[model samples]
Target: MKLTSVSKSLRKLRIPAVLFRRLAVAALPLLLLLALATGCSLFERGGSSAISHKIDQEEDVISSNGGVISNLDKLDSFMERGSGSQRIVQYTIEGDPIFIETRYEGGRLELSYDTTEDAFGPREVKTYSCDKLVRTEEKHQLKYSLKGCGEDMGDGDLLTVDFDLGRQDKFEFILKYGFNHRNEINTVNQNLVKDMLDGTVIEISDYGLPVEDRQSIYRKLVLSNYLGEKQLSTSCNLKPYQSYDLTVLINSAERHYAWSECDTGRDGKVMTEAAEYIIGLVEAGDSFLQLPAATGSVK
Candidate 1:
């Protein structure tokens, strides 16, 4: 009687071993796929978080070092408050050009360096509470101003005349005579004035002049003693309407000089000389290429 009851209980509880094993085998790939997907999701999130953190750190560095402050958040907030004056000063370090912009608003002085192209450059927003004070950047602080600041190269002389003339190796000039001076001018001047409205101003190229002639013209214009004469620095004269614009490419730099009828050096002969030589060339026409180079003092 005991054996019959035990056998009946065993039969009811027993499942097909082969069916259970088959089910487990079928689900194994699915379980492994789910685990791999979870791991990948975590890894992707970690990578994204790391990249974002790195970018934020870089931005912070740039901002702290003369870039737009991240904390300001609003453009208006960065603007200097009250009536302030601004000025820019350019200097060089290690042969690289650097610019400094200083602004004063109300009574506070704010200084920044090389911040933006049409704006300012990278430098801390240095604030000085006093109307006139010194800064830790000793050399620069001395030149600070409440109104404006500029290079105090004594005598107001520029060190260089930097020019950019693109790729062409030629010079073009336009000469126009004022209606009042029209009758006083000579034939060459008359012809130039006539061509002025016709868009036929003279064009001279480097190839047209020999090495000696080229050197002469260059010396006369670039190294001419007249360039350094303080008397030539007078204000531009806009009256009489007579004027000439000369554009040339020298040493890969494009140089331009313009003057009106009454605009002349104190001596009055400097412009007069240059005008005569140039006018002669316009009248030379095609023969100008074969004519001897101009030989005379540039007034």
Candidate 2:
């Protein structure tokens, strides 16, 4: 019998519409078997092709719009489309602003959360072996434990610092707080000076500190109680005239601490001491100075 006639008879039987639709889908394979046995055709010659074409059209729509595969069931298919090379898949969980991103590159998978709510927040990344990821996907169990995946690093570790000295000066300091104990400092339109007596711009870069010097800085930071806690107690005022932004990542605990202030108080004093100590180490002298100071006269 034609599929339409069968549907009409099922409707006459008053079967619940939902149940009837489900039953129809469930019986498709059985009907096909019967049709083959009876030497009959359940669909016209190109019916299956039309259904495949429609599915392809839907997939095209998804691919055009960021290729976000919300349905977990389709994740394998989505990955297949990447042709086993570098690909980035981004998806949101329950419409959250934070996107869960998966990066496939060099036969490894890295998962991270992408968001701007806390731009300086610590980053948590989980890496998985490509073979393990594939096996987990096949088992329909994609939830992996985050513990021991990898250590989360703070943005401060890389010296991702930003200073906004309004109407004072426009310059940049490229600093790298390397993990290998080999740090670097580069400036633009600026210079480091040994002292006011030596008013000469000290051009320096790729400065590597000795172990003792590095330890001295760390001891000062710890003594000031800056690295003792995750959050430091301090009062910050917004001057809108000048601001200092700094983030520090403690490698020992993999913790991140941020300080943003327009005027100095407790936190400011501590940070200043730490900064000067670092500068001293960089200059390898008793005192250090920055020409064309970033601070301006307060209104």
**What is the alpha-carbon lDDT for the whole of candidate 1?**
0.35
Please, what is the whole-model Cα lDDT of each candidate in the order they appear?
A: 0.35, 0.39
State which candidate has the highest TM-score. 1
- For all predicted structures, in order, the TM-scores are 0.25, 0.25
Q: Work out candidate 2's RMSD over C-alphas.
A: 19.2
How many clashes would you count in candidate 2? 0
Model 1, span 1-299: residue lDDT tens: 12243334545766477764565567556655765765433122321211111223211211222111221111122233434433332323222223333345566544444422222333223223333322112211112123222333112211122122232265333333333323111222222222232323343333232333333343344323223222333234553255544444433444445455555653234554555555554444553444444343222
Worst 10 residues of 1 by lDDT: 66-75
The most accurate candidate by lDDT is 2
Q: Tens digit of lDDT per residue, candidate 2, span 65-173? A: 2112222324456456533322222223433233334445564445444343223433233334332243131111123222223335222110011111222122233
